[model samples]
Target: MQPVQMTPAERAALERLVEHARGDTGQSRRVADFLLAWWNAGQCGSYDLTTAWGVDDTIMDDMCVVFRLASRANSYPETLGCGPQFEAIVRAWRPKLVE
Candidate 1:
């Protein structure tokens, strides 16, 4: 499949997300850290947030919220997360299941 062509704004947003997600600090940093650690550990299967990340459902939900906002930011510029960049990070660290 061909790659999606991102606008300047979208590209900028993606870069920002990559920076923050992989940064040394920030709320979403944990998400990136977990992803990296799990992937590096050869556990690239489905992620049961509560069991895998050792957090409760509430924290899992919050993490999902952060991911969703980042994924959907292209449609809603005011959102505080990265759009396609977040997707790229996830794809790199934890690819989706094949149906």
Candidate 2:
């Protein structure tokens, strides 16, 4: 499937998340690339992500890592769990595509 075109808000949110992941540039870039690919691919489901990203059954964990890293970078309170936080962001930025 062709990737969905992102809205300006979604694009900005993604860029902000990438910026927050301020660790190794290479690793950050890899994650960012993965995210962009994922989003473009019409917000593929977990199964698709697992197969495409080679994440095996630990796709949720990987998502947690991304969320945690992003939260840390942005200094958001760690109250919200990774999945919830990610979903919230996705909803806010791309409600139509996420569902």
Lowest summed-lDDT stretch of 10 residues in model 2? 74-83
Write one digit per residue (lDDT tens) for candidate 2, span 1-99.
Answer: 323344444345555554433334544434444543343334633223433353333433454554444444443222222345444444544467666
TM-score of each: 0.32, 0.25
lDDT of the structure predicted as candidate 1? 0.45
List the global CA lDDT of all models: 0.45, 0.42
Model 1 misplaced stretches (Cα beyond 4 Å)? 28-99
When summed lDDT is taken over every stretch of 10 residues in candidate 1, the lowest stretch is 73-82
**Model 1: per-residue Cα lDDT over 18-77, one tens digit each:** 555554443355555544432333543443444435444554554555445435443432
Q: Would you give me the overall lDDT of model 2?
A: 0.42
Candidate 1 clashes between residue pairs 3 or more apart in a chain or in different chains? none
- Where does candidate 2 stray beyond 4 Å? 23-99
Give the count of colliding residue pairs in each prediction. Answer: 0, 1
